[model samples]
Structures are given as structure tokens and as C-alpha cells.
Target: MRTLHEAVLDGLPEDLAPAARSQGGGAAMTGPGTTQSAVSRGQQARAGRAGSVRFAAGRALPLFVRGRGSGGVRPAFTADALRALRARHGGAPVLVRGLSGAVLVLLDRQELRQFYEAGPATAPAPALGAVPSRAAVRAVIAEEARHLTAAATLDLVRARHAVARAARRIVLGGGGGGCDGEGGAGEEHPAGLFGRLRRRGAPEGHTPLGRSAAYAGRQGQVLRAMDAVPATLLRTLLLLAAHPAEQDAAAAEAAGSGPAEDLPRLEACVRECLRLYPAVPDLVRVTRTETEWRGVRHPAGTTVLLPAHFHQRDPEHVPAAHVFVPGRWKTPGADEDLRMAPFGHGPGRCPGDRIGLLITTALCAEVLRRRRITATRPVLDPPGPLPVALDPRGIRLTLTRR
Candidate 1:
């Protein structure tokens, strides 16, 4: 008779089932210890399967412990875990059980390129024409910079508030109406609009009273801008504070900027920051159709996960993976690299990427232009191995006027 572990592996693909069965050992006999033993055997059998790795539930605890609350260090913990998994399993994609379900983690950069290239087409990013002009965005950044400059010290909380205000103005236009809680009577606020849209039921075509396409799109833009911009800004600032040489170079560029896009060094710094600590560290997608890899078939609805944080920092592919090297971005073909997907890739890429980058780079330039920033809370020495995880909330900077 087959063991209980073998029976469990029976549901998996033919290619994987046999490997699991062979390692599962003999049939189990009923006893008080049987259930626990069966589970351990099953796990071992699962791990033994080719092209996959099984992690004990406890192995995922660091993700939970470190990756909670504001600026949780989940990405860092996850990258470390992925590095270990890759080292043991080689470059092949490994199936790791996640909190939600089975996740097929993509390890190879070439696989990542193919996965993104084959992704289903999504709606094109919203038109940049709808956004406030570049000048308007810069004005908002300058205003917020004034607020920060008045203060002797800057922390994540203050930084977030500044970004939020600027995001509101840029996305909503005309000072963002009432979203910042200072609008006059009868002005519409994002929160109020969001509530109304929520009450109206899903997006257009989903329900008769659903939010209109225009309203839904506008609401989405506002929310994404508000949430993502602050995170990017904080991370970039922390990175700049930690690397004085890069910071000085970026500041020199910021001081001579013709437009946000013209500031190459500052943009590189922001890009490096995103690569190091992407706001969205992991990308997950559900297989719409059955997908096959390395002679194994994954049925439809399979969860495919890309730990971008790991791929972007993999030492084999990315030189100075653990170091802050802004100049790498200036190298030819760097932008075309699929491994460094800070915003994401292909059709599903973030629609507001250009605007978001503009906002972040501009704000960073504004801060660095005339203020010397030093990180006080976490001491980061440039030549040493940078910490895998950085908490934005824990970041504190002292700004001295130049």
C-alpha cells in the first residue's frame, strides 16, 4: 500500500508525483504519532520533488515578524529567503507554499523576461495630459521643500505628509480641493468621492449604478498617487542620506536641472532606490490558462510569484547587488533590463510610472538642492554591505542649509 505522503503527492503532476512518492517512504500505520509523522514525511517528499522546494511554516515567520506596520522590512526578509532558496535549488523556478496558497517563484532572469513578455495586454497607462503640468508639479515640490527646510530635522512622518500634499495637488489639481482637509465649503474631496464611488458599486459595466469610467479612473489615479508616491520619496531620501558621494552628485545635478527629466544623476539615484527597495517588492499573478515549465504542467489558476527584490539584487546578474551604484542605471541597456522592474513590466506596468517618477525625482532634487542631509537613526557606511531591509519609519535625517 502507498504511504499517506504518496497519496498526497498523487494529486500533483505526473512529472512531480513520482519523485515525491519515491522519497515518501513506506505506508504509514495508524497510531497517535501517525498524523505528525505523516506530515513530516509528506513535507520531505514535497521537498524532494524536482524543480521545487518546500519550506517549513516556521521559515516564513521572519516575513511576518519583520514585515508588519509602516515600513515593514518584508522585502528584505523575502530577498534573503529567496537567495537561500535559489542557492539550494539552482536557477529553476521553485514552488514555495505561501500564506495564501502554492506560489511558483520565478528565479531565473530569462524566465522573468518571458513571463512579462507573455503577460496579457492591460489598459495603457492613463494619459499624462490629464496630469498637472511639470511646472505645477515643481511648484508643489518647492512649496513642500520650504516646509521641510523650515524644520531642523526631517522624519518619515513629516516626509509623508509633504508628499501627500504634493500628490493631492498634482493629481487632483488646484490644490487638491478638500482632500488635504483645508478646502472651502462645497469642494469635493478624494475621500468623499471615494465613498460615493464605493456606494455606487463596482466599476462601469459591473453594475447599473456603478461608478462611471471617468470617475473610477480619476479615483484610482488619486489613490495610487497618494499611496505610492510617499513610499518612493521616503525610500529615495534614505538612500541618498546613506550614500554621501551619490547624494553630492545628485545634488549637483538638482541644482542645475532644466526639468525633472534633465536631472540624470538625481533620476539615477531615484531609480537605484526603487531597484533597492521597490515599493511593491513582490509581483503575483494568477495563471489564466494552464502553463508549462521545464516539462511540468501547472494547471490554470496557479499562483505565479516574482520576488523582484531578489531578482534585482541577485549577485550573479546584478553587479554590486548589495551596494548602491547609481551609475549602473546610466549604462547602456539598463532601462531595457527586465530584471530591474521597479515599476513593473509589460502590459500590467503601473500606468502612472512617468508621473510618479517625476514627482519623486523632483522632490528628491528639491531637498538635496540646498540642504545637506545626514541619516542619524541608522548609520549606513557606503563601503560596507548595506542592510537587506530598511524601515522608512525608522529613518531620520538632519538637514543643514548649504
Candidate 2:
């Protein structure tokens, strides 16, 4: 926590230094089942360490409690909850209690870096797991593309099913139980890496074919990370549609580019969409020990909620936060914006970020080059945030071949 605080202090801009100092005062520590001020911060910190274990065992009360007006849930649709949090707590860490009796520590930008970049000495150990082979993953994506091209009209159902089927095949193999059996004869490779893995009956943790519970879980996480793609992709298409000049620019850019091409305009469109609707709405982690960060004392065993949705859209960090402007990404420091965590940051960042971006951008470019897509309904009506899941509705597009 001390190291994190110093890092934040060092990173603060010259103009923002005074504000950082004032807000850097440590968080007030509250003891479990005790009135505020009844115990010293030192005592509370020690008690917090012992209480964390008891709390994990479901035997002790949370050492920290939620902000009074937080109402057990954080609302993503409206600004009320966030406004109340900032108004009542300033920059301090706000604790919010969940209906399940879980207490979460919600931290802002500076503190979040501390939480994410904690040194190996304080960081949690990495889970032992294997990722899907490149060939297997490419096979799944190719199958998904085939499905998309075969669809009569791209709607929410079809789009979601495409991604789900591909992800499942990557995780469980084409002929495994995870498959829907809709794949035709040409879809399966007779002696592919995945084929042999399926035949071997991947147990739980060990599978060279990338067929295991751990691999499947990671596949599921990736699919969830891509949840907003359909909607956000549709939105980006609409943006190009609305601005015919930009549409021409995009088409020209698309014609000259390949999948690996990092076209600035195309990237800006995707970046703007992510800024508005991040793939992962929130990031959750548990504290290993009672720690003070960004002037806030968080008890051990606290569930830390870094609401990336709120952070990326926060008005303070992003100019015209609610408005969608692809060109905003052209400004200096835009790419390095710390407030954005679409793929997360630091050591625990998603390993598939580059791959995901490549896949998404490539798909978008190909679609634009071949057909003009128009949304049948409003694509921006976000059906509220669902933490790790993307809103499943609000996107339907009809493609007209060019």
C-alpha cells in the first residue's frame, strides 16, 4: 500500500499534485463489530488480518461497511449511485455491502493502479492453466465467420450463438460434450490437435490439447470479454453510416489494409466504442491483507470492485465523456489513458488483448469492405450493466452487399 501510494504520488501531473496530496491521506480503518473510534487504526489493522480468515470461513462480520446511501447495489444505468458516492466520500475508498453480506471496497484511478500493480511480494499467485492452441482458436474463429456469412440477417441471437459456439469448441473441442452437434462434416478435422485432445478425454487440469476445466474457464472469460462486441460493433457501423464522409474514409482505409494493419481510423472507431461500453463492466478481486491505499484503509478479505465502466466514462478523466467521437482517440495521451481498462492493465492484464483486438478489427474491416451494414434498432440502449456479462439485447443489423 505504501509503495502504491508513492507510485501514484510520483505519477500525478504537476497541476494535479496538490489535489493528490490532499486526497492521499490514509483511509480510516473500522474494526469488526465495533463502533467507529472505539479502536486505534493499528489495532483495527491487526484485528482485520485475523478477521479476514474468519470472514472467509463465514464466521465473522465484515471489518468494513458500505457507504450509507449506496443501497447494496451500484447502478450502472444512472449516474445517481456514482454521484452519491463521490459527494459523500470524496476520493476516499467507498465500501459497499452486497445483499449476500459481502463487503466490497470501491477504489478510483490512483488507487486502482496500486491494486492492479502490486509487486509480486504482495500479489496473488498465478493460477496454473493452459491456453488453447493457436490453430484450434483460429479454427473456432473461422467456423464463427462461416456462421456469420451464412446467416440471413445478423441479429443478437445469431451473433451471440456464433461467438458462443466458437468459444465452446475452442474450450471443449468440436466433438466434445460442449459442442451443439450443429457442425457439419467439413467442420471437424480428422486428426487435428483438438481432435486428438477430445479422444484422449481431457480430464481436469492436464491436457496438451487445451481441453481442460482451466482452459474452458479461460475460454468462457474470453467470450465474456467479447460480449459487447456485437453491440459495440453495430454502434461503430452506425457511426460510419451516420457520417458518410467517414464511411468513405473507412472504406478506402479498409481496401488498402490487411487484418494485421493498424489503421488509425478503424482503431479510433473501436477505441471510442470501448470507451463508451467496455467489454468488462467491472473487475473484482479480494484483498489478501488489511492495507491502506490512496489514503483509504481497506480491511483484509474485502472484495475490491474496480468499476471500469464508471472509470472509463468518468467526466473528470474523459472530455465529453458521454459523447461518442472517434477522433478523440487521435489526441495525445489518448492511447495511454490510465482511466481506460478495456483489456485491463499491469501484470494481470489479459494475455489475449492483442489477439482479441486483431480479431475484432479484422472482422470489422472485412465486413465493411464487402457490405454496408445498417442497424434495424437502436444499438446504444445499453440494458444496464451486469458485471461480467454483456447486455444481450439491443443490436440487430441488416447487411446490404456492395
Candidate 3:
């Protein structure tokens, strides 16, 4: 069935400047389980040859758990803690993209409510079967990687400003636009108003769209910067970049393995990732039924935000939670994971887990093998409303390609 989000995406074609009224932002989205099946189906029909890009995940990407872009000064995450999180998620189950076809993201509140009315989805159902899958994992990792990468690329770009400034000072001993004749020195760098400013340094905070574009470009630069990624992942990304169908045979061959075993490990890995470094630092769930969590009292309908960073580290769920030793959660069971939901334990757990795990595992494995990772800047801190997957400060890695 189509969702309110799907309806909104459909509306965009007729009116680029989409208002909040008819699109369900004001009415439909407020309720927990309002369906928009008609809109989704209609859009799918309209999208036609546009393929899945414009129909399914295409419209949902913005609302994708990463959901929104980072708006302001993002806090910093401790390197030890984030690493520990990665370890926890090391071998957990995840949803492969193909398996995840036509899925929708159900938020925490929705999942919690479903517990009472919808029969609890207690048992940890296997997320992804192996079959050389990495799509869901890829999606999440792509988001997170983009988050990290955006921060890194921004850092690099900022650094380039300094480096460029220094280089220019050393060369012409002047600050002027490149267009200017050699009439004076220190006038300005002629890269243009924007280019000149870029050569020098960043201008305070950015606009909303500016931030979005910056984050998007950051991923591009980071990928280019880190050439020595996982061989399989790197080759795949490169091929995808070029001819897309470039390595279908290799991918198909890899997809031949049975995926049952992959579910548990991938889930575990995803949980660990969420615990250590969740895609969203803080997750908010509005109480549907009166409940108590960790001795806290909450009336029904009260909004509660769960900070994965803090909750994951809580002594109850983990022992010495700040460290990035994937071994901590090496033996997690479905029940145990439910309490400590990383990719969200219940139905709310990210549907894209299969793909997410695949990407994270492959990337991390590649990084461990090929690069020496180091932290140059503070990692992302407690997330705010505009939370993203990246830590603004750069995590410097001197990649020595193997």
C-alpha cells in the first residue's frame, strides 16, 4: 500500500512548490497508522518507466530514517563508544535490498502501539538471507558513510581552503580574484566570490539547502579520497558508477549462497552498529500505553526520546559499554536484543537491515584490512532534531592500499 509520504512525492510532479495541506503533512501524517495505498499505487502507475527510483525508495529517501538532514552544530561522539557500537553490530542480520522491495519505514511510536493491537513481533525474525547480499546494508552504510563522509569531505574542503590560501600566499603573496591583473597583492584570490571565499575559509554556518548540498557532496569526495576501500565494495561502487550493469555476473555469483545464516549475524551487527553509532543518535517514541522504562514513569501519549548513545552504554544492557569491541554483543539472543534494540528490536526495527549490515561489514572489513583509521576531529555528539549519521569532526584514516 502507498503511504502518506508516497502521496507527497507523487504530488511534487504537479506542483513543485508542494504545500503542507493536501500532502498529508497536516492531517494524515499526524495519526499513527493512516494508510495512503491509493496514492502509492497511482504514483507507481504514473512513474511508469521511471523505474523504482521515482516510485518506491526514491520518494522515501528524504523520509528515510536518516530521514532528515543535519541542520545545526551536531554534537560529538566519543571514538571509543562509536567503535564499540560497530562491534556490537558486527555480525547481525540485515534486510537485503531485493528482499526489502516495496517496504515502508514504520516509526518507533507505530511499532510500540502495534505491540498492544498488532500482536507483538517478539521473535527476531531473520532479516536477510546471505545470497551475497549487501543492498540493505549498503543503504544504511551509504547513509552513515555519507554522514561520516560529508563531515570528512567538509573537513577536507575546509582544509583545502587553508592549503589553497597558503599556497596562494606563497605564490603571488596576494589575495585577489584570479581574474585580476597582477596590479596588486593581497587583494583577494580570483577563484570568484564563492571560489575566493572557498580558497580562504568557510563562511560561518550554512543555509538549509546549503547544508544538504554540502552533505551530499561530502560523500562524493570521501569516496574519491579513500580509494582503498573493500575490494568487493570498491569494485562494485566503481562499476556502478560507470556502467551499473558492469559486474552483474560477479554479483549474481556471489548471491548464490543460502541467506538463512546471514540473518542472525547481520542482525547482531546492525544492533551493534545502532548501539555504538546509531544512524540517528536519538530516537523519539510517543507513549501509546502507560509504561515504565528503567524506573521512569510515563503516561500514555507522552513523547519519549531514546538516546541510543546513552541507552546502548547503560550498564544494564551492556558491560563497559563505551568500548568498540563487537565482541560485547557476540552472543545476543532475540529476547536480549529486544530490550537493547539497536536497529530497533521490534517491528520498528529498520526494514533495510539486510542491506545495511552487508554494507557496514564489507566496508569495515575492508577498512580494517587496508587502512589505518585514526580520529582527527571530535565524532558526532548527541543528536538533535536534525540528526545525521556523520560526526562533524573528521575521523582521519591514512589509507594504505593493500
Candidate 4:
């Protein structure tokens, strides 16, 4: 965790610096005790114009508010915001400046592909390096299951927090015994857990707030996944309910003679869920040097935004793009499915992507095997975004023993 924090914090200044200095671009002066160097120029720009961006960003408010306001300003309304920009700018990258200087938004899939595929020297600088260990992830998932079972009412917010706390415990080796349990399971505090983790691969020379920063970052990632998990599970259940054939296939897979047999249908359901509602719907990158992209000359330090939601749903790339087609991934020569990069793409893609898939798949399979799940609300009509998770409010599900 400390290593992850160091990698991110050490790389931040380089990530946010514009090619040249601009007036009023210095770190925001937030009164006494707030030194100029404490905040980066990019942060100042973000903070200075936060209100404008928050209020006038895009038309995603209704979609974001679906999960009881758990969805926030992360997506940035890429589809709507960039659609209008693309109409004016054509194929060239659209430059935008909010509280910051200049940001080139890449709405088209081709342009985004180029940016993401570009080598590390030119790719958008990574903001974090939080790849949870397999053990850590399994522990958190198990803890999350326990939390869900213990909850008297299904509050998405609390569930999200529970996941975050579990992750924090795993990373820091403190608090409750999620990673220290019996037989090195997720429920007890094992001896030398912290020392072992540290000696195994801890980054030396920790920064002042390295652990804290990493803990906070890990919590955010866990919360985002947790918030999305319930929705994904709900969507999976709703899809299974709507398609009896697929449900039967999944059930058969669950009841297979072998314990580790692949559950293709369940995996497909997860893929569809991610396609419809990615946790981080939009990705932002910045150029490090002056470059010419597709006949357009972009100056050094240009901010490029990859609208993942827009790209994933592009009719040109994805067949039946807008529909929830779980079996699409099972088709031969379905290279287009690779473009459904809800976790972004390329070198800096989210490290937790596979972990998230496993978590969601396990939860779906377990629930389906143990009980009959039914959705009481229309899946299409989501109520709001629960921070970053798309939530279908009043989505009642009755679970009956199989």
C-alpha cells in the first residue's frame, strides 16, 4: 500500500504540470497554513472551478442520482459533453479549460485508442497504483458477504463502507481481523501479518502520509467497486429472471460436478453489467509533450479525456451496442468485446479490473446457487447514482431458499 501511495504521489507533480506556466494557475490560496507548494497547480485549477464544473458539467445528473446520490462528478458527462464538443470540433481533439488551463477531450474511439495505446512515455500519467492482492480481494469479498448478511436493511452506502473498511484492514494490517483470521482466512488477526507483508514487498522510505494516502485511495477504489457490485448483482438477477434459458445454463454450471468449472453464463452476465454501468465511466489523460495526433497539432501537456462510456456503447464498434446481450462475449471472433473497457485500457488500466470481475462473479454464483432471486423493480428505470454506482432505487429482491 505504501509503495502504491509513493508511486502515485511521486508521480503527481509530473502528471499535472502544463507545458508552460500561466497566470492565475498557481495553487489556490486557501488562507493561512496552506502553503503554495502543498497543493499542485492542477489541484488549484480543479478546486478553483469546481463549482462551475459541478453545476454545468453535463446532463448525467439524473443518471447519477439514480443510486441514491452515490454517483458524483466522476463521469463528467462524457457522452453529452463531448457530443456537443465533437459536433463543433469534428475529429480533432476538443480542448476544454475549466478551473485548469487546457484539456483536450477525446470523444471518438479511434482518437482514444491512439492515446491509450501510446507508450508509457506518452500515455496519460497514472494517478494511482492500487492493485489489491488476490488474498486481500478474497478477504474483502468474504467480509463484504458477511456484512451484507448481517445488515438489517440493505443500505448501499453502508455496504460500500463495509467493503472499504475491510480493504483498509487488509492493507494496513490493523483494525478488525479480516486478513488475520484462522488458517490465514479473512476473519482473524494472524501473527506477523503486517511484518510478512512489509518484508515481502513494502516500498522503503515511506512518505509522511503514505499509508494514510494509500488507505484513503484504496478505500475509494473499494467503495466504488462495492457501490457498483450491488447494482451489478441486481442487474444480473434481473437479466437472469428475464431470460430463463440463460438462468438455467448458469444454474447448471453452478451445480456442475467439478468445483472449479467455469461458469460462462454467470461471467457473461457480469460482462453485460459492466458494459451498461462501468464504475469509472470516463477516463482522463494528459500529454507530456507537443504532438500531432490525426492531423491535429496538440501542444505539450494537453489533457485528453477518453470517454469510456461513449466508446463502449459505440454502435460502430459493438454490435447491438445499446442492448444487454450477455452471450455476445461467447461468440467467435468477437474482438469487439475487448473494446468494452469499463476499467479503461492499455498500460495504466485499473489493476482491480480482474479482481472486480471475480468478486462480482462469485457473488452472483453464490446467490444463485443458494436462493431464488427476483427483482421487484424495472431494471431499465434506475432511480439514481449512489455516489459512483448506478442504483435502481426501491429495487426490492426477495431471496427464497432453493
The better candidate by TM-score, 1 or 4, is 1
Window of ten residues with lowest summed lDDT in model 1: 7-16
TM-score, one value per model? 0.74, 0.61, 0.34, 0.61
Q: What is the C-alpha lDDT of each candidate?
A: 0.62, 0.50, 0.32, 0.50
Ranking by lDDT: 1, 2, 4, 3
TM-score of model 3 relative to the true fold?
Answer: 0.34
Q: How many Å off is the CA of 129 in candidate 1?
A: 6.3
| Candidate 4 lowest-lDDT run of ten | 7-16
Q: Which sequence of candidate numbers ranks them by TM-score, best first? A: 1, 2, 4, 3
lDDT of predicted model 3: 0.32
lDDT of 1 by residue, 1-402 (tens): 221111010000001111222222222445543322222332211123222323333235444555334333332333444544554444456676655667777867858876776564344545333454566668778877776667877776677677666656554554576565667754445443233444455344564334345554655665564565555666677777887777888888888776534677888888888887776666777888887654456788877877777778776788887788889999898877897988777776776677777778888888888698864566776787566556666667788898
Structural RMSD, model 2: 11.5
Q: How close is candidate 1 to the true structure, as a TM-score?
A: 0.74
| Stretches > 4 Å off in candidate 1 | 1-60, 67-77, 120-131, 178-212, 259-261
| For every candidate, C-alpha RMSD to the true structure in Å | 11.2, 11.5, 22.2, 12.6
lDDT of 3 by residue, 1-402 (tens): 221111111001010121222322211233464423222222211111222233333334434332222322232322222222222222111111222342222212223333323322243333322222234233323333332223322232332333233222322233523313654433433332223333443442367556434432332222222221222222122222222132232233234423232433323433444554444444545545674432233356544433444445544345645433334466646434533554565545544444334543444332223322233222322222112222222322222222
